[model samples]
Target: MLIRRAKQEDYCVFAAIEADCPGYPSWGANGFAAEETNRNSVTLAAEFEGAVAGFVNFWILRPQVQLNSLAVRGDMRRRGTAAALLGKTLEYARKNACTAVDLEVSELNSPAIAFYLKQGFEVVGKRPKFYNNTETALLMRKTL
Candidate 1:
């Protein structure tokens, strides 16, 4: 898989991937278009055989990078595409001088929580009823 910064033209593919991935927060095309223009945002794509297989969106805040969203095509899960996208995002954050990476995962998404833990993220806190009114969110962080 090839990982690289996403271009504005790739938003359609990015939006499609997010739509297909389970546990993704819903966002419209215009939302992604707006994100593409943010100076502090770093959106990345994982390409396989010339197609986008996954993507990660992050924001560079002072001293830290906030992992806004990470999604892999449903057909592409379990193939390390998400991991590659995440690794590239972390690399980008480090290059941009971020000292840490942070994200919130839905409490019900055990697989994703495990993936984050295996990638060196630790649970830092929790947000009560953070998703859809009933599901809580686990706040995870990793120091780069």
Candidate 2:
């Protein structure tokens, strides 16, 4: 897998990957396109065999990088695609001078929570009803 910063041309592929990943908070194509040009954001893509397979979008605050979304294609799960994307995002954050990285995972998404935990993220807090209806969010953070 090849990980690199995403360009505006990859928005369609990014949207499609996010659309197929069930647990993610969906965003419109235009929103992703806008992220590509955001000064404080980093959008990354994982390509395999010349096709986009996964992506991670993050926002760089002065002292922290907030991961906005991460998704791997349905057929590409369990193959290290997500991990590569995340690793690249963290590297980008570090290179850009971020002191920490944070993200919110839905409480009900056990798999994702486990993945985040294994990736060294610790739950720092919780937000009630942060997702749709009664779904809660686990605020996880990793000090860089």
Candidate 3:
């Protein structure tokens, strides 16, 4: 997969990928468009076979990178799309002098929890009912 900076055209497909993952928070095309106005935000896309298979968005905050969102096409799961996106995000963090990566995942998302753990992240804290004020959010972080 080719992981690269996200383009305006990629938002539609990225939104679809987000939709495929039911229960995952989704920031539709408009939301992504809003990100373009944020100088510190970095959005990336994972392309496979000429199609957007996944995407990740994060904010670079000097010593830390806050992972804001990530999703993979339903048909493209387990194909390294998410991992590639994340790997590239880490590279960006490193290049920008970031010392760590941080994110919050829904507590009920076991797959994501495992994925984060596999990527060397540890549970750092929690926010009760942070998701839709119904699901807890597990704060995870990985030191670079």
Candidate 4:
């Protein structure tokens, strides 16, 4: 898989991927397009076999990096696409002199929580009813 900066054409594909993830929050093509104007935001795409397999978006805020979104094509899961995308995010973070990475994951997403843990993140806090005012969110962080 090849991880690189996201392109305008990738937004539609990303939106499609987000749509496929039923319970996951989606930014849609419009949202992704808006990020193009945010100087601090970095959007990346994981390409496999010339197709977009996954994507990750984050903000480099000097001492910290906020992981905004991450998703992999359903058929690409368990094949390291997510990991590769995350690895690239970390590379960008380190290059930008970020000391830590932080993100919020739905408490109901046990698989994602486990994946973050395996990626060396630790639970730092929680927000009750953080998602859709129904599901709670677990704040996780990884110090670089």
- Looking at model 4, the pairs that clash are none
The most accurate candidate by lDDT is 4
Give the C-alpha miss distance for residue 130 in model 4, angstroms. Answer: 0.7
The segments of candidate 3 whose C-alpha lies over 4 angstroms from its true place after superposition are: none
Per-residue alpha-carbon lDDT of candidate 1 for residues 1-144, written as tens digits (9 for 90 to 100): 999877877888888877776666866567777986789987888899998888888899968999988888888889999889888888888888889999999989888998999999999999998988888999999998
Q: Highest TM-score, which number?
A: 4
Instruction: Write down the TM-score for model 1.
Output: 0.93
The global C-alpha lDDT for each of the candidates, from Candidate 1 onward, is 0.86, 0.87, 0.93, 0.95
Candidate 3 overall lDDT versus native: 0.93
Considering summed lDDT, which 10 consecutive residues are worst modelled in model 1?
21-30
Best-to-worst lDDT order: 4, 3, 2, 1
Writing each residue's lDDT as its tens digit, candidate 2 over 1-144 gives 999888778888888877776757888678888775679887888999999888888998968999999888888899888889888888878898998999999999998998899999999999999998679999999999
Which ranges in model 2 have alpha carbons more than 4 Å from their true place? none
Per-residue CA lDDT of model 4 for 49-123, tens digit only, reads: 999998999999989999999999999999888899899999999999999999999999988998999999999
Q: Which lDDT value does model 4 have at 53?
A: 95
User: Order the candidates by TM-score, highest first — what do you get?
Assistant: 4, 3, 2, 1
Per-residue lDDT of model 3, residues 2-101, tens digit only: 9889999999998888888889999999999999999999999988989888899999998999999988888888877888999999999999999999
Alpha-carbon deviation at 109 in model 3, angstroms? 0.4
RMSD of each: 1.3, 1.3, 0.7, 0.6
**Residue 2's lDDT in candidate 2:** 95
